[model samples]
Target: MSRIAESFKNGKAFIGFVTGGDPSLEKSEEFILEMVRGGADLVEIGIPFSDPIAEGVVIQEANIRALSAGATVDKIFDLVASLRKRTEVPLVFLTYLNPVFNYGFSRFFQRCADLGVDGIIIPDLPYEEKGELAEIAAGFGVDVISLIAPTSEQRIKQIAQEATGFIYVVSSMGVTGMRSEIQTDLKAILEVVKGVSSIPTAVGFGINTPKQAGEIAKITDGVIVGSAIVKIIEKHGENAGPYIYDYVQSMKNAVKELD
Candidate 1:
């Protein structure tokens, strides 16, 4: 089974996100191992880009730092290639569509397949325009994951049904960041998702605390934490790995409470 699918099988999946080449590629690699060791069921590596519209200030700065530090598409691929030798955790690229277009879609997916990447989450690519990537991804064994917003009331059924690996259920409306409280009707949103398909759903955006993760875990298949992690990297730099390891473990423990 695909590592992503396998994660859902195990229980509440704790998906961790980190920008590739944040402080440095070597540090990013260390962070990935720490995340896995801390019990992250899946990891989303942010491919640094010049403009990340879906991200809030935390991740936008992370992108800038990574890009400034010379994190290129080839370099990120090489990083993952080396990582594949040591671990088989589900690795998904959380990137914008422009990078893929510039790199040549076919070649990008080809390299991903060769390097054992399990799936991809392009926040900019809406469902209507996913056909192009989906067609190529199918041939290369990569899942072009889909996202369902809280406001996607009308299109939730359609989006949920066609989601490949898992559905990324956006917890709030704005760009990705940590929040004090998520006031959206997530239970109602998840209802539409569950009614439509069996594909697992993971909620992201504004999930910083263990209590928050546990509450979301009650309804979704997994919990995705991003900006909170980036803050750790920003504060600790190369030494953030150990702190991230403990943070991820705490989050994972929170999700385990769902059982």
Candidate 2:
């Protein structure tokens, strides 16, 4: 079974985040290992871009640092190729359209498939842009996941239709960041996506605490914690792994309540 589908069948939501090239390639790999050990059912390795418009301050800075360190598309594949040896959890690439275009969509997907990546989350490439890439992805058995905002039911359903892996449901109206509380009618949003798509749905944006993760897990197939995990890495640098472990464990413990 696909790692993502297998996790949902086990009656647990998944936790995914984007950590492309952090302080260094070595540290980035360490961070991923920590996230896995911390109860992440899937990991989104973002290939650092020159301009990450969808990201907030925390991740923007990380991208800059990674770019400065020369984290390229080739480097990211190499990192994933190496990581494939140790980790078996689903690995999804979160990237922008420009990089994919630059790398040649066919070549990019082929390399990722060769390296054992299970899925991809390209924020800028909306459902309208899913012609060639989607075909390329499907041929390799890689799911091309899509995202939706809280405001657009029409757009949400359209995005969900194209979503091969889990549909990423943005919990808020703004760009990605950590927030104190989730939107009030999150359950309704999840239901909206659920009503349209047979695939699993995972919510992200502004999800910070274990309490929030628990609450979100109650509604969707999974909760994605990005800014919170980024904050841990920002605060502790190399010691970020332990923080990731603790925080992920808290969310996992919370999910256990539902099971």
lDDT of each: 0.94, 0.82
Model 1: per-residue lDDT, tens digit, 1-259? 7888998998899999999999999999999999999999999999999989999999999999999999999999999998999899999999999999999999999999999899999999978898988999889999998899987889999998888999999999999999999999999999988998999999999999999999999989999999999999999998898999999999999999887
Indicate which candidate wins on lDDT.
1
Stretches of candidate 1 exceeding 4 Å from the true structure: none
lDDT of 2 by residue, 1-259 (tens): 7877876776667575756778778888988888788778889888899888889998888888889888999999998988899999889888888998999988988998899988888888867768888898899888888787776666766766657778888888778899997765777777777877889888889888778888888888888888778878878887777778888888877876787
For candidate 2, the TM-score is 0.95
- Show the lowest summed lDDT stretch of 10 residues, model 2: 10-19
Residue 58 CA displacement from its true place in model 2, Å = 0.6
- In candidate 2, which residue ranges exceed 4 Å CA deviation? none
